[model samples]
Target: MTLAKSSELGITHLPDHTELPESDGTFVKNFQEHPQSLLLTDSITDVLQQLHPDHQFAIGQDCGIYWRLTEPPEKGAEAPDWFYVPNVPPMLNGKFRRSYVLWQEYVAPLIVLEFVSGDGSEERDKTPLTGKFWVYEQAIRVPFYGIYEFSKASVEVYHLVDGKYQLLPANERGHYSIPPMGVELGIWQGQYKNMTAPWLRWWDTQGNLLLSSDEKSQQLTSQLEEVSSQLEQEQEKAERLAEKLRQMGIDPDQL
Candidate 1:
């Protein structure tokens, strides 16, 4: 089924940004208790910012996404663990975004990521018109939807094809490439934020893993230390050669 635009769907009245409700109090109860979820979300946002230093984008974690065609703007909304809407200002009216209103922005999220918490049922729910899966697939029509299982270190990506969410095949490196964002999503087993576990991470188009701020610092420090050590080795070798020449009755400094 081809998805209908807001105009075709009889959503003639678009609410202004000020008319939309920022918070519906749905994300108040331990919304993001999992530490990995927070880490992964922050890591993705950081890497994206570093990659596109000039691009403007809005990223939200546990932030309500207000999307409705005919009903009130805030009637039903989904708060994905992480969502990205490119080309939109990160803030609205010089203020940090409290939520994303589709009609007001006139752009749906390009990518939405959900980190599986309790049972994987909700993340995979496909009930028509009411389920989160249906809302993203049919209502909001997000381009890419990703479900990540932290415990199993698995990632499932779905691309919107013909108005339906279709599972995408992974590349050789077991990552799903997001063409619009020029990045790939995959699981990496490593230490982040002092916690060692399998974490979801982003990679560049060339499959280079995006490093967090701390990781980048560590890599640069390592490179500098290696250069310093190599210089010391070269200096010692030159001194030894000069000493041998001097012992053979040649003034190495004058030569």
Candidate 2:
């Protein structure tokens, strides 16, 4: 389906490129208490980059998503913990994107992820016209909305159906399928970025875990070591056979 342009959506006059607020000072935050949020975001971005080497997609971490061009940044924006916009250049013009302005981009995010911090009410707030859930569901109408609570080690996925968000049930492996991304979202228990905890991770449609760069490197290293060890054992067995043949009064190299 063709998405409506900003002018078609009642935003007749596009704001001057220079007048758009790129950074509303919302990107900067103290992550000491919630460092996992950064780790999860970075890991997902890295994995997707590996998964789709040729595609250029925008992945934002704690960056403002300005849904309305007519409204000011303060009233029209929401900064998700992580968001993915497919088929878009990671940069705007030639510079890094400071904020995702929906009207200018003409594409809403395919999926938005909110890592539950503090009391977790803000992530699930459903107050109309004000709540994060409401904005993503009604205003932006994102396809998939995920709420991950690290404290409970749970993930809640909501799919937009009939202009409302419907909770989705996990599959047999306890993952929510995200068709647009061609991956599944699930909680993984492991150490990432040196922190041992449950992390929201992505899996292939076949249920294979998508690894970060470091994890991929480690996996390759492990496979190489296993092959080397098998080679060494074979070499030792060949030497043993040669020694036994020599003891039997025959030149081992003749055959």
Best by TM-score: 2
Which pairs in model 1 have colliding backbones? none
**Candidate 2, number of clashes:** 0
Expressed as tens digits, the lDDT of each residue in 129-165 for candidate 1 is 5688998999889999999876688989999999999
lDDT of 2 by residue, 1-255 (tens): 122356554665655334567566543344432555555555567556775686678888777787664345346678887888887887889888777877688788989988776677898888876699998998888999999887899899999999999999999999999986778989899887778878788888899987776787899999999999999999999999999999999898899
Q: What's the distance in Å from true for residue 67, model 2?
A: 1.3
List TM-score per model, in order: 0.84, 0.84
The list of candidate 2 runs beyond 4 A from truth reads 1-54, 69-72
Off by over 4 Å in 1: 1-54, 69-75
